[model samples]
Target: APDSPRALNGISLTIPDGQFLGIIGPNGSGKSTFGLCLSCLLRPSRGKIEVDGLDTSTPEKYWQIHKNVGMIFQNPDNQLVSTTVERELAFGLENLGFPSSEIQDRVDKALVQFDLTKYRKHAPHRLSGGQKQRLAIASVITMQPGLLICDEPTALLDPRSRAETLDLLYELHRGHNITVVYITQFPSEVLHMDRVIIMHRGAIVEDSNPRGVLSDIDLLERFNLDLPPTVKLADALRRRDVPLPAGIVEQEDLIQEMRDIPRGAPPGDHPESESARPDPTETVMELVDVDYTYSKDLPVSTPALHDVSMQITPGSFVGLVGSNGSGKSTLMQHLNGLLTPDSGRVLIEGEDLASKETDLTSIRQRVGLIFQFPEAQLFEETVFDDVAFGPRNLGMEGDELTDRVHDALQQVRLDPEYFSHRIPFNLSGGEKRRVAFAGILAMKPRYLVLDEPTAGLDAEGTHQIEDILTRFRDSGGTVLLVSHDMDLVATLADKVLVLD
Candidate 1:
């Protein structure tokens, strides 16, 4: 372990006061480790991190340094220490020995600003992944840290929530003069930053303003970093001999570029467009006037869905887009029989899911639902056992069961021969996501639904999901995906359902 490569090598840098900085790179690039060092959570192996002339390694100055630089981790569930949302938000203030009145005031302000006031009394664990992420950010900002180091703080949020959070951070930097260091894998998130650092294999390779960092398309591709959607669109248009201007990275530029093209056939419709056409098959599943509400007895009971109806066609790819609390996740749960409607019925292949005689096991075997976090669904000791659990439930056994498990793992780009015997908990985040995907695919479900499938995935992991989704549709499987990635939706989905 001591001989392993360093996580942060020659990563010397400086951040001025009130600067909005962004750090991005591929997986295992030491971005998170750098943030930890800045906040004094981890001491640098060789160099040092200083916050406001205070060395992070100084033992006596540790508490003061931590107060000066607040950090919000990628996983909100891990950051929340209290049972209720309000308690969690107030924990940091209480630790700083703030007065009761001030703590209440700060907590109230955070609750309203983050749109979390309605669920202040709800358990943190009960909140959606996005909501939990919001709570984590709200909790840290209430501490009034001068330098806030965020590690993928908005990774689990919906598109609207993610944009709103970034906008809030920008306002905090401009108005409160807080130095913000934001770490993300999404290229578009850094477009507005005052400065951006590109990290690779634990080293800083590029340091420049937002335009300089995003304009170099070849550099990002060499490092396997993803291009922003608008950048990709501009590049593609340029390759078509349109010769559009360089440095185009916004949606408005693309709209203007399209307007100059004279609107021939509405774009994307060519003579050889049969392969790209969407042909819907017979209905596989349908929801009729569904209604659902959570915590009916509580004082803050909220309706999740209201008279929502939708149909899932066989072999068709569907994308569900929405903001947090817009019932996207709640609606996805109904498809797999995890939540039943209050008044309406769910039809699986024209058969009523509400019928007492219906078999849930058979339905679940035909429909697979992947949660936002893969760890929630992985419980078996070994990877092989975890993937085989679903198939075995359907009475599969012997060599037949093993083949299904192996093939599914291969579909997710995991070599079953090497990964089968490994412990599920020992796998990395990306590996765990692939394993979880394999577990559901092992069942050979006709329909698959995923919630934010690529929330924290890198470019490679994102490509793997895209390939799998395409192959699934080509083989007559139905996929309904909920995601914040508009680019992915445009590329994969034939039809889209907007929730809010």
Candidate 2:
């Protein structure tokens, strides 16, 4: 029995039919592994996994359990295998031996449900992060499973897309009464769940109603989970002797509570130490007259960056955020010479990045660019080899390469000895990300550019990443982070960049 390696470690929980449950934890806390076990992706090392009165361990029941439970993985790209959006959804239904007419009917219904009818012929690869995420969900929906388990489904999506996915999930549960088990790292997302299961170090730390669980600031802090902004703002007001209504989790509720409270004199009118509040003049990175377009003659071509100018100065952690089609990815690709501007120029360190044959290698050496879902870039046979890929390519060999690889692994908190020989495919989602970060860190670039670096991490993994970025900045390294996690930006960034 393979009980010792990937054991569940006394996890005992139950979800009744048609109930919605949320699983939360830091990275490697067994949240995803537990979900995978439930979905039959990984056979449990120990313990029982059952669904709809069927034991998962029995061979005959495996097919039955799988037929009733559909799982959507954390990464959109990994789960997606079809070329066109429509075909992707249809493949699952067709494989189940559904009649041709029924298969087509289900596919049409799913497309409408996820609002992907317009993109029926679109390739899954070309769709934006949010669109890809929705397509994955659509494929699962077409299967018509009684139980739906989503592992951080919105991790890579923009704010609007994340919101839309959440809305769709709620609708699926409400209208169809499908049993749903959702996992997420965002504190606000957990606030709406009917039930919450918190995991810590591979065990259930707490399981209760959202309000009861979230109100315990001490427990959440101990687990490195951030309090929702509304709760934090309320706590700040409470510290200042301002009374607020209980159970407020959203800005609207806080606004309502503020209206009910006695009107205090405005800060300018009051003697509340206005001298302490600093003006917002800090800048970290700046771009001027940036002009970029993917193609010149294509009728569908549009400028990815057009006369765009912005500033983010030293020690100012900024977030670049936008919707799916808003060109956020294209804009970032230019930061490290992954893409060049069609016209105009970009400057870093007062040196032009768009000038003729700009020393791109040096530019890249100075700025570490981590792509979206960077974990997928891992191709080496061992973890050490994967992390050492970048530095080795940079001409570091022998002892120097070894030292950089070790240091980078430690920076991401991955155990060097245990992970050195481990294949990247065998690592968990969170571990793979840290490995990706280690690869970039091995280069020791002064300015780090991350694109959705924490895309699929849970609360614990997100915390680890936030700590890593903060430490990088404190050490005098600048970071140009591209992410859709606004809450993360609000908590860690000194500035915010909204791409149109």
- Give me the candidate number with maximum lDDT: 1
Best by TM-score: 1
lDDT of 1 by residue, 1-500 (tens): 78878889987788988899999898778899899999899998787778899988889999989877889988887789998899999999999999999999999999999999989998887777788899999999999999999999988887778899999999999989999999998988999899999998899998998877787899889877899888987898787666578888888877887677754543343465555556666788898999988876678676888999998888889999988778889989998789988879888888788788888888898889998877668999999999999888878999999999999999888999999999998776778988999998998899998999988778877888899889988898989999888888989998899986
Candidate lDDT values, in order = 0.87, 0.80
Colliding residue pairs in candidate 2: 26-460, 27-461, 283-312, 283-313, 284-312, 284-313, 285-312, 285-313
TM-scores of all candidate predictions against the true structure: 0.91, 0.84
RMSD of each: 2.8, 4.1
Give residue 228's lDDT in candidate 1 (0 to 100).
Answer: 89
Could you tell me the lDDT of residue 194 within candidate 1? 91
Reference-based lDDT, residue 90, model 2: 89
The segments of candidate 1 whose C-alpha lies over 4 angstroms from its true place after superposition are: 3-5, 250-272, 275-281, 379-381, 392-397, 423-426
Model 1: lDDT of residue 322: 86
